[model samples]
Target: MEKKELEYIHSFAEYVDRFIRLLIDYSPKLVSALIILFVGLYVIRFINRLVRKIMVKRELDPTLSKFLADSLLWALRVLLFVTFISKLGIETSSFVAILGAAGLAIGLSLQGSLSNFAGGMLIILFKPFRVGDTIEAQGVVGTVLEIQIFVTKLITGNNQTIFVPNGILSNGVIINYSMQGNRRADLVFSLSYDTNIKTAKDIVMQVMLNHPKVLKNPAPTVTVRDLTDSAIHLSIKPWAKNVDFGDMSSDILENCKEAFDAAGIVTQPFVREASKG
Candidate 1:
């Protein structure tokens, strides 16, 4: 029994020695890997900050810039992970293959979402329209409230809120009305054939020019548009600041009514909302 105990102690001692040797052999590798991980993370954060600063300097859209910075951060971290694994003698090629396969699977499963994400990136990058701009698309005309990564929010003239997915918006045609800074209103007036055409033209022109909001440089024009069996039609074209476009139409129509009544001119004038694309 004493001889067997001695043999057991010897065997335990040998196992301990082997463990010690193994630890010593791997300690340096483990320490280096840890150092790289910590340092790589720090470097990634620093780079992300630098990229964000650059984007700000370039005046990139705020939402788009943040998205780009986060994407770069994840890509860099993935590369650092590959390097970290390679440092520890892991088969990096096999790991990369696994990552690729996983990515492909995920991409397939979320193809619709990916398409929307891609569309969002394009819209933000190209800036076909911006928040606060009045736009017409998807059978809706409204002012843009927010431009987000997945959807754009709009407030319609009737005060209805709308959310449009980036995928459909980017693919469809958009009409931006505010980009021009000014809009033209076409007011049509129909007077009885007996009414003096020259008097009607002068009245409409005076109303458009005397208004404070209308642009004077273009010189408002009143011309005979069409003659029907019931009346003679005249088109009154005036330009005004985009912000005042809707108000301008209402005011012009009201003023024309008062003016014609006072002038003893019998006429009916109607205005159409400015159409733009």
Candidate 2:
């Protein structure tokens, strides 16, 4: 029993000695790896800042600049991490293979998200629309709030926030109302058939000219669009700055009604669709 106990003690001591020797052998490499990691992190941060400054100086779009900076920072950090691990005498080839496999699995699982990311890249590159532009897409009309890697945000006329995936948004038709800086208001008004077409047109034109927001260069047009059984259809089209489009359109409509009433012009209900005989 005594002999057995001595053997166990000797075995324990040998294990401890081996562990200490291993630590002694690896200590410098581990310390060096830690230092490299810290230095790499600092360098990455500095590079990120430098890239951002360069992007700003070049007047690049904010969304694209941020995305590029973040992607670059992450890739550099990953490379630094691999270097650190390799310094510790770990075989990086196997590590990289495992990472590749894992990335493949993750990519397969997140196909939709990857597609959105690609779409975001396309949007940033092509610049179909920018932030703060009023756009109509995916059956929703809204102001562009934010453009993200995976999704784009919009604020509707009713102030509803919508998060649309970039993948779908990129594929669909986007109507950018503010792109041209000016928009035309297409309004139709109906009056009794007895009302003079020329007089009604003159009144509408006068109201449009009086409005400060309406543009005069393009000129406001008021003409007889159609002659219906119940009323005369007049088309009132005016051009205004995109920013003031909604307000100018509403004001023009209200002012036209007031002017018509003052001029003793009668409004009439007309059937939009004619019955088939």
Candidate 3:
């Protein structure tokens, strides 16, 4: 029994000595790999923080700053990962080359999406339009909801959301409806052909002038714009603050009735074509 115990101890000692030697032999490589990994991670994190600080200091848009920071961090971390792999005695040159080639192929295949991404970057940097701004683009007019990396979201007056690619938005003409501070309201009123043209114009002009919300600085213009076969057409032009446009429009039509009654001017109904029986 004693000899058997001694043999067991001897076998255990051999096993411990082999493990120690193995650890020592590979210690330098393992230590170097660990140091490289930790330092790379630290540097990447520091640089990411630094970039965010600079972006905040520059007063970049929150969405844009977040996107840019994430993209930069991802790129840095990928590079660090490649370096870490190399430190572990892995030949990553071919791997990197393959990744680059694949990326290029994918990018080429998705040129439209890539263009949108680039255009989105330009939009964020240049800031042609911002969230909540009313704009007309790509035959869609709405308020901006979000400006993402590849697309812009808009909420229409009808409460519909639209996603427009940034490529078309940036490349095409964008009419910022809210940028001009004020908007012009143009409305046409048709009166009976026999009705007094002068009276009709006077009534419309008076209605516009009396409106409280209407801007008084730019005097409203009322004139006989066209003469149809059945009616005398009068055009009413007024300028009002953008925010007041809808309110003024709704009130103007209602006020015209009172003005016309006071002036004794009558309007005619539009006639529709009759189909052949």
Q: Higher-lDDT candidate among 1 and 2?
A: 2
Q: In candidate 1, what are the lDDT values of residues 105-148, reduced to their tens digit?
A: 99999888888888889999899999899999899999999988
lDDT string, candidate 3, 77-128, tens digits: 8988888778877899898999999999999999999999999998898989
RMSD of each: 3.7, 3.4, 5.7
**Candidate 1, position 171, lDDT:** 100
For model 2 the TM-score comes to: 0.93
Query: Which portions of model 2 show Cα errors greater than 4 Å?
Result: 270-277
TM-score of 1: 0.83
Q: Candidate 2 or 3, higher lDDT? A: 2
**Candidate 2 residues 1-277, lDDT tens each?**
6999999999999999999999999999999999999999999999999999999999999999998999899999899999999999899999999999999999999999999999999988899999999998899999999999899999998889999999999999999998999888888888987788889999999999999999997998988887878878888889999988889988988898889889999986432322211
For each candidate in turn, the TM-score is: 0.83, 0.93, 0.83
Which scores better on lDDT, 1 or 3?
A: 1
